[model samples]
Target chain A: MSTISLEQIQREMAAAVMTPLTPDDNMRKEAPDGRSMERVAASFIAPNSRLTSFERLEIYNRQYWYRVLGALAEDFPALRTVIGSRAFDAMSVGYLKAHPSRSFTLRNLGGQLASWLTTNQHFAARRADLAVDVARIEWAFVEAFDGAEHEPLTLEQIATLDGGSYLALQPHLQLVELTYPVDDLVLNLHKQEKRQATEAGVKHDEDDHAPAKLPPIRRKPTYLAAHRVDYSVYYLRLNRGEFHTLRAIRAGRPLGEAIEAGVTTARVPAARRPQLVRQWFTAWAELGWICAPDLDRLVRST
Target chain B: MKNQLNAMLLTAALSGLIGGTTVAHAATTSASKTTVKAAKAGLQYVNGDKPAKHSCKGKNDCKGQGGCKSSDNGCKAKNSCKGKGGCATDGSKMPKAV
Candidate 1:
């Protein structure tokens, strides 16, 4: 008998657990050519009196997939609702196969889901665009929930702002400009799910648990701000001008330049520009979305 | 030779056992039903009881009206509840449409 090193054992275990489950076989045959699924399972897993070695290993394999799938479903409830349960299950399995959880935390599991769904439109068929929008917003919510935090700019600080000064946004603040009004859809679905959970006194465990029936999706330009206030994530609706201005600011544009860009929006009337800009800053300040720029660092750089 | 024979017999028995269990598992799982064995194993992870945040309670206009209603001037948008209710700054309010 050949002695297997700890590294080899770990590698084999990972391969076995990562591979999708099979019906007749406990492991997929995609393991290294020489090591059959049975051989890999038997090598590391020890069977108890009641369970066989393969069955013991199978337990881990099934749990690994279920854990990941459950995390994804929790993250993207609206996405799951948009595409029915059976399709969601199949799509999630395929997505995990393509982009396995590389990070230690399950929080980053669906990081690549929105992009993945774009290329694989067959998953949602005609509703592909809607799915993409929901996925993006949901992922933003997840990111904002535990993303980095920063102190917001105080009104006193803003009172003495210079034109040359640049403003920064909170680290967790996310601005998403979407084609369909999916922000509303995501929020509605989230509320409905919560209501159902409350009324039933138990959370919906099934992935395909349909949310209350939603209205037909109509294509309308939507802007959304996903930000955390007091450790809770909330979605704020933005108008066309506000979205453009904030996006410019987030993209590192100076405050003056960002305001100029926002007010110059073709959709916004030229006459109402000044009042609109004032209102935007006031509301953003109240919401704690703006952060004071590091003036010391800026001066040193200059 | 005796050890090899024992290994072969064990392999055969394991294959039969796995096949039967797999079929049974598939039938129950596909129907979105968990079997007693699976339930006992505690396969599902329930999320914590933190309720969804309601920071944007009156803000969201998913029900249709009062989002970005266009006034005579242009788009008069409100963070929540249009026309001078909550949130002091009415940035969306313009003098009159030009």
Candidate 2:
């Protein structure tokens, strides 16, 4: 028996687990580096009294794909609904093939999905843009839901800040400007799914059944602020002006400049600009979107 | 010591290949553990409140049409628009300003 190094064993285990499982005969043919499935299985996996070597190895292969496929589906139901299940399944296979799970956690599984959807148009077919929008919003939801928490800016802090001060938005707050009203569409789909689950008296689990088809989506420009407050995610629909201003602020613009940019770009009449800005600021402050700068970090950096 | 160093190098190489510093940081930091629960807690489906009712053009026009009077903040009062295709408050309504 040849002594295999730990690296070789780890690499072989990784390779074997990633291979898509097939029927007994075909499994060997698809083994990495033209090695027979039995050969590869015997080299890495130990056979039990009840289970053959190939069967033992098959467990890992099936498990790897199943776990990742389930995670991706859970993360991007709207994307799956937009593209349909068959295409979604194929897309998952292709995506995992292109970008396999390297992280210890499954939360980062769909991190590259937006960019992947951009390049892989075939998966989305005619609804590529809509698919991309859904992917971005869903990913944003994932990030906002549990990405990071920051100290929220208080009304007192806002009062004390000078015009030269730059405001930082909370790390959990994500600003998404979508071409279509994808925010409403995603929300509606979730509503429909929940309603269906209630009616059927079955708990809503993504792995249980295929998501029902969604209604046709209209192409109206929509702005959404996905933020977490008290450990719950909320999607606030923003007008164009509010979106731009918030976008500016999140990009590290000064408070005075961000307000000015929002007012100028507002679709409403000039007379309404100031009121709109005030309303937006009041609402944003209430929602705790602004983050107070860390004085310790500032002092250290200086 | 040499074997330990090699293992550390391998782990570093694997981390680089995976390439999510936040997630890697999360693996080491206590904060990341709380994140898993927080993320799941926030995944509860929340539907946006219905668009605020517009003013009627005529006196009779507003009659029979389901419209909740908007407060000064532009959001309907709590339980004001309930059950009328109003906002689907999953249970608790978050304070929202339209």
DockQ scores of the candidates: 0.01, 0.03
Docking class of 2: incorrect
Predicted candidate 2 versus true structure: per-residue lDDT over A59-121, tens digit per residue: 557657766776787678778777777688878888988899887656678889988988998
User: Please, what are the lDDT tens digits per residue for candidate 1 over residues A50-138?
Assistant: 55556566656765776677678867878888887767877888899899978765667898999999999798777888889989999
Candidate 1 segments whose C-alpha is farther than 4 A from its true place: A23-26, A29-35, A155-160, A203-213, A293-302, B1-98
Task: Calculate the i-RMS of every candidate, to one decimal place.
Answer: 34.6, 24.9
Which portions of model 2 show Cα errors greater than 4 Å? Answer: A22-28, A32-34, A199-216, A268-271, A294-302, B1-44, B47-98
Measured by TM-score, the strongest candidate is 1
> Per-residue lDDT for A66 in model 1?
61
Worst 10 residues of 2 chain A by lDDT: A203-212
lDDT of 2 by residue, B1-98 (tens): 64443333333322322232233234346655555534433334353332222232122232323121211222223223234322222234687898
> Which pairs, if any, clash in model 1?
B73-B97
| TM-score, one value per model | 0.68, 0.67
TM-score of chain B of 2: 0.20
